[model samples]
Target: MDEKRRVAAVWLPHWPVERLYRADRRTRGKVQAPKAPLALAAPGQGGVRVTACNRTAAAAGVAPGQLVPDAMTLCPGLELRAADFAADRAALKRLALWCGRYTPWTAVDPAGIGEEPDGLMLDISGCDHLFGGEAALVADLQKRLHGFGLTVRVAVASTPGAAWALARYGTAPAFILLPGDEAAALEKLPVAALRLDDATVDGLMRLGLKRAGDLYGKPRAPITARFGRHVAQRLDEALGFAREPISPLRPPAPFRARGIFAEGLTRTEDIEEAVRLLAGELCRLLAHERRGARRLELTLFRADGEVTRLFAGTAAPSHDALHLARLFREKLAQAGDDFDAGFGIEAAMLAALATDTLAPAQDRFDAEGADAEALAQIIDRLGARLGHERIVRLEPRASHIPERAVVSVSAVRGATPAMRGWRAQVEEQMAAALAGSLARPIRLLARPEPVEAVAEVPEGPPRIFRWRRVTHRVTRAEGPERIAPEWWRRGERRTRDYYRVEDAEGRRFWLYRDGLYLRDTEGPRWYLHGVFE
Candidate 1:
């Protein structure tokens, strides 16, 4: 048993062509001689060129990168289709995501050339035991993918580079490279198996270094000097002398619980029941770890290979299983009628994507505490039903400008990070200022409206103003209150002079001048800012 990290590379040699067959089988329920010669063509320098070919086409000598006319000459029965690069990439992503049931760490191989992503990388380090052993895991993957009409070559190796190379270039359809045997096994493959681009591979082959073994004991200085560090780096990575990390489509959660049903579940009710049990198991894990889930995800893996994922989030960290289960209940209810069981669900996984420290609370309950919990449940339910982004609340920002003083954030996050850098100072300033002036108007316009005002003095309060094409006479007026611009932050903003006044109809208005008056200069423009009840 090798203690080093293990990676599984799954290469779909004809992904661009096979994906179309898979789609046909999925939508039309069966394939009509899908083994017939097929090739995908894309517009290249010289009109259309073949980008990918199925096994039958390859057998007929119609290989990729060949001109359409040449390939047609080689294989007259070839079914040609314009390459749907986008659909192929999306299907690859979906396939990679489906592999998560085997292990959480699965990513599309980053080494694919051009716009085509043809393989997946799986970090199956400690995950082999779940499926008996590494050999079983590889066999299971190949078998399942083959059942889906995909021709796959899978290899497990200690290093991702080695696994990727072996999967594509090794003699076997599915196999494993013992951890310490990478150097020996990799040497037999072509130098291109090391994931080098075309130019580097061509350059190395011209110098008679056509095999990985040719460079095994050769001087590194000359090879690196001619090809730069990339050649040396790829060699080191393939042999496990260098480190390479695969970025997973979704990072594995710290806390998780899995459930496998003996019989496939076809009804949504059964799925909900399974989710509840899984939630209970997950909450127990969180409690034992002294952590609580802030966001949770439920993944249902169907027997037919289609996966359904549902997500729920809470306003605060929670370990209560019932509350957590209710969150997903709302999601399932929201997905009513649109949810399909496909061929029935065979396994379910619940993971806490985000978590936080949660200390135990007192058993004694208080009215305020109960109300707070009730409110959190409401927020969670609403956020789950309506999108989390749609359920938001205004958070105060440390800004002097009224327009910039508040921002809308998802209510699922009860508070921002635990930093009080400028917020503490702002709170102190606000408390001190509250004792000096009356409260601000409850009704503030989104943006200040312009008004034509006449004042007795250049810096005094307005006597009357014309706003929104309506004229009003000022019956009660207050002195001007000046506000200076935040020059340190934004230098272009002007100083403002504000006043609180009431019209003859008892409607109170707050108005401000855009800039202070200078000697004989045109007075600053006046604008109505808010209204007071």
Candidate 2:
């Protein structure tokens, strides 16, 4: 059996086409803010000149290499503005996804934007039978997308090259083909059908070989000699004189559930009922396909033509509709409060955005890992209520400096690391040291506050010292554990002598003195910082 394909091409008018005007520029809202490309160059006598025109912009009477002033003069009352590349790209991607109903295999054309991604290629293969044969399938796609006001041209052929050529060059009932007749069908088509460069096409036209048929009947030697190898090469491939590969855009991730309400569901209960039915439908499809979902997406259509999306992820793959419904309950509940069912949802789609493979869980000696799942659910709930950042897990950073350690991550998804082996022992020791010594204030100042002090000793306990306008008498003190500042870091480096001192009130304090007494006029100063409760 010969391989037959039904390929459909959608013309994104915004896509660069030569001299063809695009009106979609008006759709550029605040997000993109694209300027209009056409403007009335003053009510002119004949026509207006183009100011800044691209190939597609020029095709609309804004020709390339044409002076903007001349273009405005040629076509008066032309709307001039900047092209919104972002909006155009987004619309193209949406069109690709919309094409899914026709075939699982659809690919975008090599040409984009200025080149105008003319159409998409679909290797319908065995799938066309589901839509009641090739012609009906094309008709169905045309009817649906045309409702959206899209201009589409489709062609079915034995090879991608033949289909592509006919779509661009042929007319409607836009498809053309005959079994084992590739050469004859493409014979009369222009050289442009082979997707050759503009320079090549112009050169071929000048040589009086305007059509593929003209070149097909002529001597091979002279055509190659005049236009070089690339021209003849593309012609040969399009005519199936050489093998041409078809790279269809891989079908997007499959979505199994589609919901259509009986009377357009308006109430929350009605929507939930619809959602449950859709989830069940998806679950059945997933089971039949022998796959499980990791992430599920629910798309809700509001009566007013608004689409709302909800997303959920599982720790493991699942195909249970009830479980999926539970995950969506919170979101669906909220949607009822916020959404205005202007027309009632016309359509809804339930899809597994991600899936994973796994074997069935066996009965365990102890209860399975529900704790982790429950915690995840709670965290997710808290994150939804209070911004995600408000609920976080503190992860210890591998640094000795207290402030350098401990980072925050969303509590819902992050896993706490186990402090095992030497690390665990060190943490335990640090905990013990803090707990046994004294009750320390939770907030520790970044650094000690320096203060001028007078001690009675020649290296003995201080009799009196004033710190921040408070006088203190140190009755006893322990020897200092001197610490030197890091000299490599260029700044005011210092040496510290720390002491555990008891004041006259018998209250213990941690104090440090910066720099040793030298011949400099300044004396050693003490600083009281962190409090030991």
Candidate 3:
């Protein structure tokens, strides 16, 4: 028979407390917990209440979800800290990245609001042998996590659900269930081990289904009908009858490299050197894969449990190490005082966040080709230093309205494929149309400015107009092109009678008369809409 797939679940019981304590340690430069019971509070229905508690608080009978007043009354010396959900999530994501040393498939399981425990799931099917055995891998994981001053439970089983149950609900700190042994392992555990909600678990317990074994022989339909489909689904997943795939925090990068220092490096020069090395390594990997990175991120892991991330993007996909390193350097220079190396950085990781197929370019003897490449590189550098939002290119949009005809998008990322193709098709059509028509203005105003004008009667072109506090007599006028607003979009729209007029000084302008004079009781209004070279 084929061997069953193995999954490992690593549970961090008091993640919030640990995260708080670590932050405190970093600030105070000491490894000490508060003398009094500590709790993290969140706003609840019954005023502010405790959402998480440290061991000291839990030992003093200060349970989660308890009112702050009651907890303080129970332990008068209780300390309360506001919950930092964003910080906790960031820490968990960094931990997931650190776990990449164990398996490529690692996902963070964050606790929802009001939930106690949070954990990580890793698919370690063929990785156990590398660390001696399954048990040895778990032991190593536990030891490494303990070194980081975290309390954790490690469990391995044939399925992710089974491993999760054993890790969080099992009696031991570490446990492993062999293939086909999940049923026996989970039989005596509480129904909560199936990852059911409190309401469902309560209902099951009231029905005399406290342990998983109580419903083992029962019909699936009745259980599902009573407690809902989640109960049956969780049970089946735990019993290896269903598949549960983990969505990783970040998709695995196609090209990546890491540099680890024995002792943390604090100097900026040293950090840059490490980044340069990583860039070279990543470039080699990309060359081997025949792909190039368009977006890259450099992550610095500090000794003080802080992670700093820097981003760089390219106008085009590139596999050149020096160019990539220069991009990172530009980003670092732009960061100025924002990027910190608290306590010093122990590891640096370079990841290609977005990649695309890359092939060798033709000979660059052509000056235009070289100029184009140079321009792209310049744009990439400027974008890296000045921020992508500040470096923009005008892209043609699908609109007849002058204000909506073009959009500004980041030059580095360029336009979307659909937008680019649509613009190309529109340009092709416009080229054919413009071949027989008069030239359009070089610059169009976002909003046309109202103008006072004198024109011939019977819908003729303007003879003179005053715009922007200046009067100009029309020396030449050649248009009465009528452009009507989309009647299908709205009712009672105005039709513009446009005229291309040149002044005595040879300055040309696009003037439009709004509405029809005979159709509307009020006469038409004139506006200056654009300028021509």
Candidate 4:
């Protein structure tokens, strides 16, 4: 039999209130404030409604979704604060980062409609022993979080669903259910503890199924047919019959190196040295795995609890430690004053965010391939200094139209293989595609300019034309090659008759008559489309 994995859930019952309090304290620089009832509200149809409330507000008969007027009536001195969802989400992300010390795999539960998230899920699995045991870990987490002025409930179980249910509704600050004990431990909990919606819970209650134990032996078909598959799925997940996966906010890197300092270092040289050391260690890891990083991230954890991150990308996959360090140096130098070492950096972590397969290249005695590699490195450096968006190359796209045939893309990512092949084929077939004519223009106008011309007939080539106030008399005329619009596209379907004409001064011009003469329009319009060498 496979060993059961352990999971832990950390529930913060008053996250919104705590976040607001923290912000207020930080802005005011006051540790102690008035202990008045407070509530966060959002504009609703009737009036502003309470979204979250502190314990004091709850004790004064205020609840979430309650109208602000009613809450105010219940507590005359109630303090109502507008909710800051962005700040709350940012705080949750930072908390998830801080939790990285406990477990590498941690995910923040997304906030539900009309409710802010108050919990995080962590896959502890085989990591419980590091803090002595599961019970010890729970105690340590609770104690440490309590120092942050948060009221937290910690629970551990065999499944994420069970751990989440027990952590939020287990009637204790800390709870643990051994493997195979989930059913018994969750028997008396309310049906809502299964993560059901309010309507489902109310419907279940109306049917006299008030607790989880009441549905334990019932027929699955009847319940699922009435309440839907989610009910059965959640139940199964809690009982370990169905798998529930947790997606971490940041995926753990395969190659990582970290440095911890006893005393924070503030000097740029010290930080660069630390980065070099981490890059060396990371490159060693990549070497062992026979891979190279395409993108690297350097994270600095400040002593003042701020986190700074820097990113560098390579044109080609690279595993050389010195080259990677040099790229970071260039990035940092370009960052200049933006990369602030606020109150010094206590720790530095280097991670290979994205990687690719890299095989050892055979050394060459000549410098034939060396120049290409050097050029790629130079492009990489330029991309790191200026943003990648600023360093772009024109790539051929799959289009027959002159203007739509080419596009701009990041130089670091290179061009698509299909586009390159298409361009090559087009170059080889130029003569045949142009109908045996070698009069293709050297420069094509972005948008054709209208020209006044007098053709020999309504359907013939131009004989005299006035373009940009200059009259050109055609001495040689070649074609009336007809081109049609793409039928698949919507809009006006105009056919163009192009002509390669040479003026009396030996200057060649490509002009086209838009629309068939008297077929699609009353009179055809002449346009100067291109200039031939």
Candidate 5:
């Protein structure tokens, strides 16, 4: 096992980020509640006293998910509104950012990963000198987050588990573990801090293993048999007896290019020229690094102490300077008509959010072969003009039906193909299908439209019917291929009998006759749905 170093674990206590967003909506009175509680009460703005009713607020009578009306009934006057998770999250991210001021290895607590999250984790082993020492560093962090309106706890230990347990469970005296004394230090802490499931904790509790020390003396075989090996493993890790791997959340790749205004820039044209200069410099940097950027960030630092950041990601990695500048040009065109340039802009930094290695080009190629560099440049220019969403390629989907055979996603050029096993299976199924097994159209509407029709059928597609108003006579018709709707999503839907027909002008059309003739209450209807290429 590897020797453990100084690791400090930080959790947000609760999901503070979510709480922040909730405050924003609730403050504007935009929140609709049976009786909304005020979120933005000024320091001295007096309102009715509303107390939380759990043991912490529950003991006061407030239960989680209780409606304002019901809660008011229980306490006569309960001040309650939704929690502001966004604002809380923003505050938490800011704290995470500030933690960068402490150590570059800082990351947001994992509480934001799923619904009821706890806190963040930081690996501060060798870099405590900048803030003096461990004790002083923890004190500084606590003061900062507290000033930002957060209740936080810091724990420093040799192992992540010990630090996490201390932060969440251990009392004040043992919050900061000393060197070579983890066993005695963790003895009194509750077993729940081991990150075990509720059932495991309950089962351990029933076995009289209340404190972490209680499980310390248990034999490995018996513990493994009775409570499973995870219990023993967690105990060993927390007690510094077994090794546990710490996976620090990776920050996005750092790729930045900056431009300083000779004189402060205030006009849109000045910003554009600055952007072009920065993009060109960024491209040179990317070329030097032998990588292409997939996302570009433009940060404008205003003289008024405000930062405005714009982000645009490519479907593929590219380092074309002219193409990069053009992408921002389209975005700038869409800015508000009354956009104000307060004070002036001092600097701009363009960063790459994603990147890929460009392949070395071959010296010679066949005449008919595509030029990779030319293709990339073309894609970059088109991506800039049409917007990222507009340029895409159809990726094959794993369905036997023609309509479900492919899907259009934001195209990534030269991307690694998705799961080979699944692709092989789909290809095998599609290989055996007959060309005329079903009449399929080149283009299918994203959604189906309903139409009224009097069909000559033992319940089949209509010959003469009105669709998007042009009544078409079915000269040639194909058999009905029924496609059932996915019932789990929208419940039971009308069944479709699809047919390919040539209209009066030899224009080919794909139509669907929905429902059966006099099926239930509604009559059979014809829908001119798709055009054949």
Candidate 6:
């Protein structure tokens, strides 16, 4: 049952007026949260209209949806601030991210079309115990937001709909509904508490259903015919009969370790120490699950609501705390001056984003294994400093063409199955080289350069060739090694005869004739393709 699911809704009543004047920019010396009577105004068919008002304006008989002239007459000293709907929405999202300090499962309440959002939702299912209990968690959350001069109301319950209704309509500022008590707790509230639109609420009120309890056990068919299924769906969701889950701003990482400090940490050294501790804790968590991490992320929450994140990846899955910590250290070092600890870092968390199953095994003591481990460490460090794409190794491809026989792949991915016989291939090439047989040149041209050649025979090696406006005579040459075109490819049906030739200056060139010898046809062309090392 979802009775175990605990969600909290936080409503910021004055957000529309406060967002404009809040001291939230990266730089200081800006406007502070409004304390005087203020109203947010927007352009309408009339001269102007008030969309929302602060507590002082509300107390002075100034309310929303009123013409500016009428509102000014009600509170002559009312201050008017242009409503910035876009900025308010963005600020609300930032506030939701700030709530990550309480729980990673935080999101801006999804507002319907034409509705302005001024609230946040948190799914703190298994997170309440960290702050003592459900009550204490709500209390702490409210206290911290109030510290930032925000006016908030909070409610905790088993469902998001229940919490949302209670936070906005319940009598108490901070309320908690015990599991399985949603119906009883919400019955006495107005029908609007079910989050119905004004037209629907008015229609229900006209039907003598002014309170949510009035809809209980009533015939659903008539209501469905009149109001469709939204009302019933919302009612079922709030009463815990149906599910309505909030989508968090960021999904919580499956494996994570968090650290909170009484006082903010300012020094880099202290943050590094905190990372070390978190790494050790994360490694233990992975070991318990018999998994290893391949990618990791570290998030630092600053006191000023600014968040900084650092990411690192490994060439191989690892549960070694020291090696993982070293990877983050390299990332931090690379960040250097870009890393800003504004005000101070109040909390930090390390999460394993990508993981793989790992089986325990004895450490290898052989030189080859040690060398491999060392190489992986180097790759990880370099990847952290530069980029993983920049750290690449050549992987063998299943192709006979010299140019198409290899591809570059990121080192972090290691090698592929096609590379299993790479060692044997290299050994065979070395044996040919030592036996005075010609092997492929180390440096191959992007495309063969056309050359003028004079061969001893029609299909034999070139006696001399002119390439790049330079002429060279062949001192010694090897016979033709015929290479045929791939049948699967659509190109000229011609075969190439490759030859290894050396000049008097000890410079070697690989030359090839384009076509086979024909009795009566256009003569074949010769090209210089490569230079030997």
Model 4 worst lDDT run, 10 consecutive residues: 25-34
TM-score of each: 0.77, 0.60, 0.70, 0.69, 0.46, 0.90
lDDT of 1 at 120: 96
- Model 6, 1-533: lDDT tens digits are 29899999999888777665565433454456556788999988677999889888999899877999999999999998889888888989988988887898999984432568989999999999988998999998888777666789999999998899899998899999999999999898898888888889999999999998898899999999999999999899999889887889998889999988989998888898899999999999999999989899999988867688899988877888888888888888888998889788999999999998887767776788778778988999999999888999878876656667787789998656876768977997799789877778888898889999997777667878899998899998885677776788776467777889998889999988887667326678898889999
Which pairs in model 6 have colliding backbones?
Answer: none
lDDT of each: 0.85, 0.61, 0.82, 0.82, 0.64, 0.86
Model 6 scores worst on lDDT over the 10 consecutive residues at 21-30
Candidate 2 lDDT over residue span 17-116, tens digit each = 2112323322431132123344312222344332234333445566634555666676554555544445555555545544544554667765422353
Candidate 2: regions farther than 4 A off: 1-7, 12-94, 97-136, 156-160, 174-185, 213-251, 254-368, 383-390, 416-533
- The TM-score measured for candidate 4 stands at 0.69
Compared with the true structure, the alpha-carbon lDDT of candidate 5 equals: 0.64
Q: Per-residue lDDT for 55-165 in model 5, tens only?
A: 233344655435555456665544444454455555555545445445545565553113334566677776576567888778866765554434577888887778888
Tens digits of per-residue lDDT for model 4, 174-263: 998889998898899998888888899899999999998888988889888998988888888988888888899888877888777877
Give candidate 1's whole-model lDDT: 0.85
List per-candidate RMSD values in Å.
5.0, 8.0, 5.8, 6.5, 12.9, 3.0
RMSD of model 2 against the true structure: 8.0
Looking at candidate 6, what is the lDDT of residue 90? 91
| Cα lDDT tens digits for candidate 3, 1-533 | 11358888999877888787776676766676565688999899779998788888899999978999999999898888998877887788788777765566788864422464378888887768767899988997888677566889989998888888888889999998888888899999999888888888889999999998887879988888887788888888889888888887668775788776878888877888888899999999999888988999988877655668889898878888888898888887777787788778877789999998887778866697788667778888998888877988777765555566677787887547645576575677689557754456868888899999998775888888999899999999877777776557586477888888999999999988898977877778999989997
Question: What TM-score quantifies how close candidate 5 is to the native fold?
Answer: 0.46
User: How far does residue 306 in candidate 2 sit from its true spot (Å)?
Assistant: 7.7
398 Cα displacement, candidate 3 (Å): 7.3
**Better structure of 5 and 6 per lDDT:** 6
Clashes of each: 0, 34, 0, 0, 37, 0
